[model samples]
Target: MTRIRLAPDDGKAINLNWRDRFVATDILRDAYVRYEESLNPSAPPFVTLDDGLELGIVHSDVPAIARAISSMLTCSLEDAKNENGGHLPSAVVERVQLEIISPWGVANLWGQTGHRFVLSRSGGGGRSEILATILVGQSRQTIFFLTGRYNNLRHSTVEEEVDFDQPAGDDPDQRWFDLFAFPEIERFKPWGYHHIANFVVAKGHRGERLSRRLLEGIIERYAKDHLDANERPIEHGQHLLCGRGFWQIGDPPWLTRMERLGFYLRWGAESFFIEKPWAPLPAVFDGDRKIGNLEYNRSFGLPERYQGPRPTVASDEHLLERLPEVIALSEDPNAKLQYFQTMFDFC
Candidate 1:
């Protein structure tokens, strides 16, 4: 990963005011431009960092920049306080960071249509820096492709038939279904539903009701009608039906965190553990590690129960029940599903 550290001298001359901290936008933009140019000199120079702040790149960049931005905001806020004779209040500093990184900020940057990144603000009108974000968008076809009910051939040159093949030997989807005893998965269709992925929070900001604020923000935003990219009214928009992620098996703290956010273990557990698996584990859980008695044993030497971490598919039943109404009101439901599948298809 590339890290961009702005030089202290660069910001020393700039007079920062609490009321006009946006003047630093150009400085932050310049830092990002220099960072990108250092990695790719032959490419055209970045015209503006605003373009990079769009939803597509921002989702991926959030984790990469979270620490950097947090540091930058802290420095800028401290500088403002020093310049103003230490009169800046903690609430003011928190409010500034909150405004800059809040969901409203993302919506303003990406526009209100056709983007998936959702951010959250602190509850009770309290000010705090954005602690987490989640990506939510239509993903019916992704489910279909994963289940082998459909083939995502958007990038392929040749025609192909529906992929009815059974899940591969090490396929996590199959393991997920087996864990939950969800035998009726084949009959499931995720129309009028959004899939959440890349749920991220700054390491320094965890344990601060991150999931509650983020999920609340998502529900609050999607509960209302919104205009699509083509200016069509979308009623009851942005419902989250499912998510695919991985976690260490028997990790109660992690499970509790997810459940509090309305995500239950729909698919994943020790009963379906795989050994000598072809599929790779996520980087966070790809080693011989221990959490109490349960070791994340990555090889075949350990007992089958501790052989490897599990792939998880989590869902909120409350959200699942609401999908029918969303699908009913959704215009050209088939076309919408196709468009989402095509847009997200990378296979």
Candidate 2:
């Protein structure tokens, strides 16, 4: 068995409970086993299989989980589950509690620490769970999750002397949290430009059909609560918004799961781009001139190796075209603002 820590407390201090449950190599090993079995529909609901043993599949997610199971079992999860009956239980969704300790902490630690957790029930006598967190700010939304540890589960930090007293507004971008925002930049703004659209989901949870649900849920929730029936933006203090783009690590070897989640390659920086289903982009800034067009105070850039469509190139155009419509349709103004601002900061 191996040991690894999942969530850390303040980088310096660690939560022993979370560390033991999520990071301990041994516990992770068990969790991994349950994860593998969950992907294999042929495997009984709660039945565990010995390594290399022939097992039938039962029910599982379409492609992503199938791929993961196939890779793990050296057999297709579809084939295994098909051999059984192709029926699996619905994933148990548990909304984990998350608390932002400090105001600046939410911006500074955003993705690094602000996300919450959720778990799924594995087979009998075992637990299969997924931990996910979303960081919304600057009109940018990033969700990070730890599935079974193999696909997406890595956190790195080093102690450094610095100031924690700087007002959060002073550095709304939290330049210090580059790693947290790197994935989005990598996928959406590879050429060093500001990209308002971006998102990423780790491969592990892709198989569970969780990504699409999560993404749609985010968008739908934003639409319903954030936007009004007229699609006008509502006024809220600082808040967060959620969208889709390349928000994960480099191109994942497995994308079938990603594709099923309503993501498609939009060229350049991101391999997966979430289609903005609603008409017009949401109005982000509070004070502005003109009925159409959102304003930005800074110049945006494109990321390196970016020769494709750049966000900065089309940002202004997109703003003009989407602003009025977004304002009319959106119900949550603060979230819309946060999303746009985050994009600026992320870029």
Candidate 2 C-alpha lDDT tens digits along 1-347: 23233233322221112211122222323322222322233432222223211111112222222222222221112221212332111110000111221211222233232222112233324433222222322222222332111111222211122222333235545332321111232222222221221132333444554445444433433322334443543221112233232233222222334445443333222211111322233322222322222121111111221334334333321233333333332222211211122222111
Off by over 4 Å in 2: 1-131, 134-138, 141-207, 223-238, 242-249, 270-347
Best by lDDT: 1
TM-score of predicted model 2? 0.27
Score candidate 1 by lDDT. 0.31
Cα lDDT listed for each candidate: 0.31, 0.26
TM-score of each model, in listed order: 0.33, 0.27
Runs in model 1 deviating more than 4 A are 1-115, 118-130, 139-192, 224-253, 267-273, 276-347
RMSD of 2: 20.0
Best by TM-score: 1
Each candidate: RMSD: 18.0, 20.0
Local error of candidate 2 at 152, Å? 19
